[model samples]
Target: MNREFIEKLENNPVIAAVKDDKGLEKALKTECEIIFILYGDICNISDIVERIKSAGKVAMVHMDLIAGLGSGKDVAVDYIKNTVKADGIITTKGSLIERANQLGMYTVLRYFVIDSMALVNIEKQDRHGIAQPDVIEILPGIVQPKIIKKINSISKVPVIAGGLISDREDVMNALNNGVLAVSSTNEAVWEL
Candidate 1:
């Protein structure tokens, strides 16, 4: 994890997770310092990233959602860095996170916490001495406080609460749970 990147996120906890053109436009007009580009393809992705950069915000492309990223391969990481020019990458695949890190790109590892077994992922990522991602984003953002505590206790990586983060109450709930930040596609939440 890059301390500088974490510092940036700490300064502004609301990250704009844009999945469409309207969302992107709204995000660029907000106070958000980080914009998670959740929509785009191999062709127009570069332009989308450029617009985010032009707005002077950190642009993080979610690899899996990008149509042309080829299932989150290392080469896809390369394309994002060398061609798309995004500030960071967000993915559920640890391998992609590792690859992005190797390229010196900020990486966010996303996880869907559906059950108590989410703790297994912490050990799994750490098993082979593999480095943890710069940040870990847990889906269904309204995860239980105890679950948040458990993850924080197990890993030092800053946690970002994403998915289903629709309003201020949800945002507050996540932040109060010890997450470093909250990412939401809801434009109103971005205002908060």
Candidate 2:
């Protein structure tokens, strides 16, 4: 991860995760320093990213959620780097995380921790050092303080609490528990 970018995240712990054009517009007008785009296609992803940049904020695309990008990691990474010019990318695939790191783009490896097995897998992945993403995003962050603490204890990478963060308290709870930041699609929460 870029140290400067990470610092920005630290200073502003609330990240706007937008899923549509309306969300993007609201995000652009908010106090958010980072925007995680969960919706877009090949035809408009670049435009959206550019718009975010023009507003002096960072834009991160969720590679897996983007339509028309297919499943090829290399192609998507290349496009995101060269065309979209996004500040970074968020993905659930370890391979893509590695590839994005190689391309010098910031990466957030998202993990949906629903059980002990998932927690064990995250530990194993961190230990093996196969795909060390710049940041690890734990989903359903609204109710996983223990899980978040566990991941933080074992991993050297910064953790981002994402998904289901609906209010200021949710954002504060994640940050108070040791996450570097919180990613939320809730426009109202972005101000926090």
Candidate 3:
């Protein structure tokens, strides 16, 4: 649905997924244009998003991981958009993705590929307005190339690799398999 964000990741696939203050500090100094704020409570979430925004990087906060926020309602999405001022959100929940999309925020649907059902889930990602994912991030960046190829074939949206991405080889493997980008906590891989 969002071709612009897709293009941004395509140009610079290296993304910094920050889970702590140290990671955020380091992420600001890197070449990553997009930063995933995977940690933060309600108390400090705004400041965290502010810092990333001030640094001019797209800030995508993982809602499920953020503490002090209720996940059962659309208020959380409203808070993230209006209060936190994040560029977008990364979530596994379809409802949240729908809410975020309605708010005009950038949205990434994160999927953990554990089996064939997971692949089937990707194929089932349809347009119900809220069901749209600007891009889909598949976990375990080290999956088989055919699996990655299968994902690309089924998904109309761009795909990215995440989780357990340790080295350049893992990044290369995913990219070679046709993933548009790779997100990693490893700083060394960010330099790739």
Deviation from native of the Cα of residue 186 in model 1, angstroms? 0.5
Candidate 2 vs. truth: CA RMSD?
1.1
Q: Which digits, one per residue and each the tens of the lDDT, describe model 2 over residues 44-111?
A: 99999999999999889999999987685687898899989998899989988888888888889998
Alpha-carbon lDDT of model 3: 0.89
All candidates' lDDT scores?
A: 0.89, 0.88, 0.89
Error of 3 at 188 (Å): 0.7
Give the C-alpha miss distance for residue 14 in model 2, angstroms.
0.3
Error of 3 at 103 (Å): 1.2
Model 3 Cα lDDT, one tens digit per residue, 1-192: 777788889888989999999999999999899999999999999999999989989999999899987564789999999999998999998888888988988888999999999987788775334478788999988889999999999888889999999999899999988999999999888888
Better of 1 and 2 by lDDT: 1
| Alpha-carbon shift of residue 99 in model 3 (angstroms) | 1.2
Clashing pairs in 1: none
**Cα error of candidate 1 at position 15, Å:** 0.3
Per-candidate TM equals: 0.96, 0.96, 0.95
**lDDT sort, best first:** 3, 1, 2
How many angstroms is residue 96 displaced in model 2 relative to the true structure, after the best TM-score fit? 0.9
Show where candidate 2 strays beyond 4 Å: none
